[model samples]
Target: MSEHKPYTYVTASIHEGVTRFDVSFCTSEMSAKAFGGDGERPFLTLSSTEAHMTVTTTGGGPVTEQDVTLAREIFTASARYLANCERLHAEQPVNPTDQTTPSGEVAA
Candidate 1:
């Protein structure tokens, strides 16, 4: 069986001092020989808004198309649950606290 490539897309917006994100993803199924089943048609899945946080403050410049596109990609790829087995993995941690190092760790 051959590995399938996964696709991702993202969208973002700010409202009421909060940042909102949305994401979409799609992937194809491996051949049946890989799963020990009859060959099945490819599949597609989507996930979004698993978790989010408010910006509270803006440093500068208005939102740009690049920012929006990046945000959308982030949200889509990181949704709560994916419908497809072959899916893109979220790069950022679901929780900020989880990303933080221990007190002894130095801040970069």
Candidate 2:
């Protein structure tokens, strides 16, 4: 059997209402030989706001010698995240459609 190489992946974590994520890109040993480091390296990141209402990506550009579908991967992950957000929002007990305040005044 041929030796296995690590595959690119993404991970997520939540802390203090903030969701932090990381994207790891796999670097082949051959690429490492031609380039420098091998294995998985952080390629991108996504983070959530304090209110857990928004998610933003914060990271530098990827520096690598290998050719990979970086854009597709990122877009796929983002789409999944948005879908999950929508699902969770739908599952919330509080109705977001209700805009009336306790004083019976319409929230502006």
Note each model's CA RMSD in angstroms: 18.4, 18.5
Q: Give per-residue CA lDDT, model 2, range 50-88, as digits (tens).
A: 211122222333533332455467579879977997865
Report the number of clashing residue pairs per model. Answer: 5, 0
TM-score of 2: 0.29
TM-score, per-candidate, Cα-based:
0.21, 0.29
lDDT against the true structure, each candidate: 0.42, 0.48
Candidate 1 colliding pairs:
10-72, 10-73, 11-72, 23-76, 24-76
Candidate 2 displacement at residue 106 in angstroms: 24
TM-score of decoy 1: 0.21
Off by over 4 Å in 1: 1-6, 29-108
